[model samples]
Target: MGFLAGLALLLLGLHLIGEGLSSVKGKRYLLARAFSRPGSLLLSGLLLGLLSGSGTGLSLLALGLLEGGIFSLGQAALLSLAATAGAGAWVGVVALAQREVAEVLLALGLPLFLFRGSRSGGLVLLGLGLLFLGFLEMGQGAKAFAPLLSLLNPGPWALYLVGIVLAFFLGTANGVAALALALMPFLGQGGSMALTLPLIHIRRGGQRGS
Candidate 1:
């Protein structure tokens, strides 16, 4: 985690922290408390979908917020599901678009606009920026290391599980997904993407419990 990756993680942390803090602050800031509403839930879900298009981090954040008493566990879980599903939807779109930066920016922009002017917005923006930059960095890094990605492309029935376990432990599904995508181009041309379903499902179930 260099400057960009660290920044993205930090921003994401701020968003969740702000949500929890805002809820804890109570009646003193009715405006801030508004984020706890149903609309906010939907927006948060969509934003989660857009950012990395992986619900793992969003779900974990929801769990943390719930634990902190920002939102009910049920609400947190529901939003997590929504966010994950939404991200899956966006992933399909991303695949079709074949333009990661454009797709990511579109996804993240909504939350920033919706959450703007609030205490959490500033940090969320920072995190979102970091995440976006990190995403670009990862993609560039992947392209630079094409031979390495090629070596990992061919599977031996273990890469799928390896990807999931690595993702879970690393706490960064983006990294896992990058590896998956890299391997995908070589997995019998159209087969690499097929593994994504099982891998994502595996990570999803484990992360929720975590």
Candidate 2:
């Protein structure tokens, strides 16, 4: 029941986002102008990479903002790949440090499988459905570890480190952000500093619009 409700919310949110983006099609010219600048695409990529690495949804939102047909489909595709990769790497490292392979795959693969093929967006709906189910199973498993939580309670730094790993493997900037928020109260100063990553890029290049 709870999982169904959550899945419904996820679908609703995606619908609203798609609708909103479509409504703004008139602004394509302005975006074209901005995106056409020489360093603009790379800056956009950097902004996306940093935001993605930090676990914020800003990078994905950056992709949406650029989706005004200002940039070619190829450019947007590359940006999505880069942003997701950077974000995934950050989360993957953290996840491996905290948990086993099976847990990690359940956290990721289930969604990928569910959302594999769709004409418009059966993918989004199904993926969210799988994620909701996955998390519920996770929570059930978590109950067994309740006793361990008490042991780790005083050592909040330990949890924050674990939380960082949790965020990274999830492949969700939003998930990462939520985890960071939940764990922030428990974290010490030095713990927060560990979140930053060095510049994320090899060579971001594309044509500029005039």
TM value for model 2: 0.34
- Looking at model 1, residue 148 earns an lDDT score of 60
TM for candidate 1 is 0.53
lDDT, candidate 1, 1-210, per-residue tens: 243353354335335434533432344234226546777877767765664455766676676667777778777777777777766664344333233553464466556646645545444444444444444444444454457647766454455566556656656554445445544534544445544545657765776567
Top TM-score prediction, candidate number: 1
TM-score of each: 0.53, 0.34
Error of 2 at 89 (Å): 24
C-alpha positional error of residue 208 in candidate 1 after TM-score superposition, expressed in Å: 8.7
**What RMSD does model 1 have?**
6.8
Model 2 C-alpha lDDT per residue in residues 15-133, reported as the tens digit of each score? 33233333333465665566575467556555444322431243344456556445676566555555555554543333322224334533544454455342123333333333333
Off by over 4 Å in 1: 1-40, 48-78, 89-119, 149-153, 182-191, 194-198, 207-210
Most lDDT-accurate candidate? 1
